[model samples]
Target: MRLATGGIMHETHTFSAEPTAIETFDVARGAELWRYAGTNHSVGGVVDACRARRIGLLPTFFATAVSTAAADRATFEAMAGELVAGIAAALPVDGIVLTLHGAMVAEGFPDAEAEVVRRVREVAGPDLPIAVTLDLHANIGQAMVEASTVVVGYDTYPHLDAAERAREAVDLLVATVEGRIRPTMALVKPPLLPVPQAMFTALPPFKTLFERAHALEAAEEALVITIAGGFPYADVPMAGMSVLAVTDADIQRAERIARELADLAWAHRAEMVIRNVPPGEAVAAAIRHPERPVVLVDVGDNIGGGTPGDGTVLLAELLAQGAQDATIFIADAEAVRAAVAAGVGGTVETAVGGKTDDLHGPPVPVRGRVRLLGDGRFVHEGPENAGVPADMGPTAVVRVEGVNLVLTSRKLMPGDLQQLKTVGIDPLRQQILVVKAAVRWRGGYGPITRHAIDVDTPGLGSVDLNRFRFEQLRRPIYPLDAESTW
Candidate 1:
């Protein structure tokens, strides 16, 4: 059997002022796409599954970029055209597999992933079996459900289950190609927009919800169940929580299960909202505790959720409190240039963060000694991107007082311990670690930290959905309306 694979993946934060240019995207095709073979990513899982099934894989074009604002129109066109053309070239395939981020919004394309499926379906005809996998934060839509043969989403929030979910999709694709199961998917979106802060699968509310979904899967009532918390940053009509149920040729059962899961999520809507502590109070509490390390999460500047990594709100509080044995990362190209010029063990004075926009706090002036300079390249030793090489682009470590400020040219979330260990900072020795992220960081740092706190900081990635003005989002959503019903 032969299966063609590849698609475009991106999470668009429409609220971000930063524009996503064509140069920002990473494109790979043909043999180059084989680099994902051993990584804990979507493509990696597809490669392994094909090998195990002895299926001839036709690798095609795949493009992705870090979460950012709406993608450029020309870039979006080029990517979509390339992916569709690849599918056209690799004809006579038994099935297809696509990896997509369902929340992607580009110029002129509100439902980007659905557009990809539509273009492919137009060329491959309606009878082709297509299987797709999406992130847990996908903004599920009816158009997406109707276009693909079957859809599967990551069940875990930190998204450690990327390969696992992709393998499941491949299994379903093989089953359909063998004429075993015909998938009919149903989608249900509740009138709620719960932030990513309260959507950790390991904790309460979400844990129970995912457990219920798993039970349904074990009972064979549903082949796959997805509970997406939804990305609220994109101000679109479909920007909210969604439940998708896929069953074998049973549309009614799929719809009933989806509705049941959606109502259950709506019932616990109040418990899903998380409160935050101010930066000063968070620092004070960390200092008072006897634990060796405490993780202070900066919700507003979450790099994974599409915010600039130069937020200085928490940095200012740490400096003001004269905090000791603390470390934080900032994406500042200017700081890195200055530190590199000063060389190791030399002192450099420069304004370190908040240069991209006025949404995050203003730049805080800091004078620190350059402790180390690195090439800013390391493989993720954590669950998020295990075995994948990350490039921060010209990195340096500056120690201002007792705090070690890691400045990089690229905006990267703190997802792996190797990001710090590559620059000589031991994660186990730090008294306080300020991570500019929400749930994603917990995959790596959660196991080592004694406690983690989310601070109510100010930036584009605010947990409070009311902080930003929405011009296009549909009304009557949770917290925004409070009395909204499904």
Candidate 2:
């Protein structure tokens, strides 16, 4: 059997003042897509699965990037047109597999992933099966469900299960093509918008829901089940938790299981709330902790959640509170250029961070010595996104008053330790570390740090849903509205 695969992925933060331009996306065409092989990413899983299944794989066009604002109208259209055209050119394939982030929002396309799936459906006639893999943060809608034959979402919130989900998607696609199974799906959305911080799958509440999903799948009651925590940052209409079930030609079973799981999640709605510590208190606590390294999470500037990585609130607090042995990463191209001009071991006097917008915090002036410099390229050595190569453009580290400030020319999510270890800063040697991220940061920092605190810093990615003004979100959602009911 032959299968064609490709899709665009992004987690859009509608509150962000910036528009994701075409220049910001990373594109991979035809043979280039195989570079992801051996990595933990979805693309890598697709390549490996097809090889193991002895299926002919046709690689198309794929473009993705770190979470950010809505895609520019022209940029999204151009990419979407290219993606559909690529799949069209590779016609006569038995099936297709698409990897997408369902929370994506572009200008004129509130349900961007659905739109991409729709376009692909138009290219490929109605009979062919299309299998899709999605992140756990997907805000799934009926359009995505009606367009795709089988939809599979990651079960783990830190998203360690994406590779497994990809393998499952490929397996389902092959089975459908062979006439071994007829996949029927059902989707349910709860009135819940739990923040990512409180949705870690290994813990309670969230864990219970997935455990039930697993039980049903293991018993062969459902072919696949998904419990998405949903991306609350995107102010789209479908911005909430979702439950999906796929069964072997059994739509009734799919609908029954989906509704059952959604009800279970809603029953635990109050526990799904995310509470944050103030920046001042969080910094002080990190310093006082008996642990050698404490992770201070800047909830507002979460890079993985599509906020600017240049948040200065925690950096300023670390300095004002007289905390030492702290390392903070800030995305500022101007600051990096100034440090590069001084060269290694030279002094740099300039303000770092908070350059993109006024929401995060103003830039903090500092005079520090350049401790390290590199081209900012490394493969993730951690459990998450392992074997994936990351590029931060130009990068440099400046040390000021016993605190190391990492400045990068572009916004790179701190989802892996190699991002710092490649630059020569030991992760275990620091007393306090400031990570501009939500839960995904735990994939790297969680295992090493004795304490991880989520700080209520100011920016577009605030943990508090009340901080933003949503124009397109569905009303009467849980936590957002106390009286909201299913």
Candidate 3:
């Protein structure tokens, strides 16, 4: 049996000022992406599962056009066209598997995934079994449910199990292709829920929510159950918590299970909302901590959440407070270039950040000693980015007094400890670790951090969801309205 596989993964945060262009995507199709795509240990877990079942493997056509923020309409459409065409050309296939980030929004299209699914369905025909795996932060829409036979979202927020979810989708597709089962999708969109920081599955309420959801999946008819804790930053009509169930054509049962999961998420809405501490307070608390390693999360500047990753507020605060033995990462290409020109030992004075948008904060002028310089190439060793090789683009380690700062030409999310270590910064030994990331950093750094605190600084990735002027979101949402009931 012939099979087709491909992907269009991007989590667009609408508030971000930067527009994702076509060049921003790291597209890998045919054999190149597949060689290292499913070979990583994390991906191996999924590949092994499929191998054990003796399922024939097909070449994957993956085009990952991921920007931290909203993409330009033209760029989004063109990329979608490429992905659809790539899969279509390899068609006359039995089944299809896709890996997608559910929160993507293009310029004109509100439901990007729906459009992709529609295009793929038009080419592959209605009888073909299509299964998709999505990020847990996916703002799953109704059209996504209607276009595909089965949909499964990652259970964890940091998304350590992406490949595993892909395997699950493949398994379901194999079952459908072999005529063993008929998979169908059902969706339930509840009222707005809290952001990622508040909905940690490791904690209470949400932990119980997944537990009960899993218990339901153990029942005879249920194949898979997913609760998408919607990406709140995305200002789309489909923004909110959603429950999806994949069953053996038991539409009624799937609908009932989905509603039950939605109810559970809505019931604990208050507990799931997260509040952030100011930058000054966060740094002060870190200074007071007795533990050697304290991870300070600048949630507002998180690149993973579509922020510009150039916020100088946190760095300015750290410098102002004269924090010693601290490390901070700033995504400023100009600063790195200037430092490189000045040489490793020479000191240079320059204004860094405050370039993306005026709303966050102004740039801070600092005199720093250029320490180490590198080409900025490294393979990501984190659970979230197991096999993906990343580039920091002309990186330099600059020491502003005692605080060591990591400056890069490209926007880099510190997903792994090696991201710091590669530049000669050891987070474990340092007293304070400053990361420009949201909740995803916790997967790698949580174990080493003596204390983890989410700080409210100013940037494009602001957690103040109310600050964003949303024009398309559905009305009467929670938090946006204090007294609204679902």
Candidate 4:
């Protein structure tokens, strides 16, 4: 059997100020996509699954970028055009495999992933077996469901299971093409917009919830079950939690199982709440917590969910609280340039962070000595997306009072430890560390973090859903409306 592979991935935050331009993406063409084979990303899983089955593989085109604002119309069209063209060119394959994020939004396109599937279907025809793997935080729409043969999502929230999900997608596609099994899928969305902070799958409430899902999957009637804690930042009509069940040619059974899971999630809606402490209180708690290096999660500046990585609210609080031995990353290219000019061991006074937009906070004045400088590139040492290459562009480490400011030229998710070690700061040695992320930061810092506090700062990824007015959302989602019913 042979298969063609390609995809575009992004988690769009509609309220974010940043725009995802085509030029900002990391585009991989043809054989270049194979480089991800050993990584923990979904693309890597595609490569691994194909090799294990000895199936002939043809790589097409893949484009992705870190989470950010919705792509402009032109950007989406250009990328989608290339992806479909590449798949069409790699014709005569037995099947096709696609990796996409479910929460992707573009200008004039609220259901972007569905649009992608429809375009692929136009070229692949009605009978071709097409399989897809998506992020767990997908806001799944019905359009993609009817077009693709099978759709799968990661089981883990920190998304350690991304590659695993892709592998499963490939397996299902191969099985379908060989006539070994006919797959039928059903989707259900619960009207809940829970924050990522409360969605960690390892320990819950969520852990208990996923266990029940596992039980359903183990039953002979179901092939797989997916629980997607939808990306809430995207103000699309489908923005909420979703449950999916895939069965062997049994649509009725799939629908029944999916609805069961969805009902369960709705019943537990109150438990899936975001508990955010004020920035001042969060800093004070971090300072007083006995645990060395308590992780202070700046939910408003969440890089993984697409906020500017330079929110200064926590930094301002740290300064005000007189916290000691703390470390936080900020993205400010001009500040980095200034630090670079100051050279290692040179003192420079400059304003840093909150430069992307006024929503995060204003830049704070700080005089600090530049301790280190680097190109700001590192390999991900992760349970999530492990072995992927991450670049923060030009970087400089500046020590401001008792705080170590690791400034970068680009916005990056704090999902890996090497992102910090590359700048000569050992995270384990710090008393407090600030991560501008929601749930994914746990893949790297959870092991050493003695305690974690979610801070409520005002930016695009804020857990408080009411902060941004939603015009596109399906009316009356929970918390936003207390009377909202499942």
Q: Candidate 2: which stretches are off by over 4 Å? A: none
For every candidate structure, what is the RMSD over all alpha carbons to the true structure, in angstroms? 0.9, 1.0, 1.9, 1.0
Cα lDDT tens digits for candidate 1, 210-231: 9999999999999999899889
Q: What is the C-alpha lDDT of each candidate?
A: 0.89, 0.89, 0.78, 0.90
| TM-score winner, 2 or 3 | 2
**For candidate 2, lDDT tens digit of each residue in 1-486?**
899999889988888876798887899999999998888889988999999988999999899988888998898999899889989999999999999989999999988999999999999989999999999889999899989999999988677876778999999999999999999999999889988887888897989998999999999999999888999988999888999999999999999999999999999998898788999999989999998889999988989888889989988888898888899999999999999999999999999888888999999998999988888989998578888889988999998897899999888888788888988889899998888888888887778888888899988878778878878899889788878877
Regions of candidate 1 where Cα sits further than 4 Å from its true position: none
TM-score for each prediction? 0.99, 0.99, 0.96, 0.98
lDDT of 4 by residue, 249-296 (tens): 999999999898888888888887776899998999999988798999
Model 3 global lDDT (CA atoms, 0 to 1): 0.78
- lDDT score for residue 284 of model 4: 93
lDDT of candidate 2 vs native?
0.89
Task: For residue 448, give model 2's deviation from the true position in Å.
Answer: 1.3
The CA lDDT at 53 in model 4 is 91
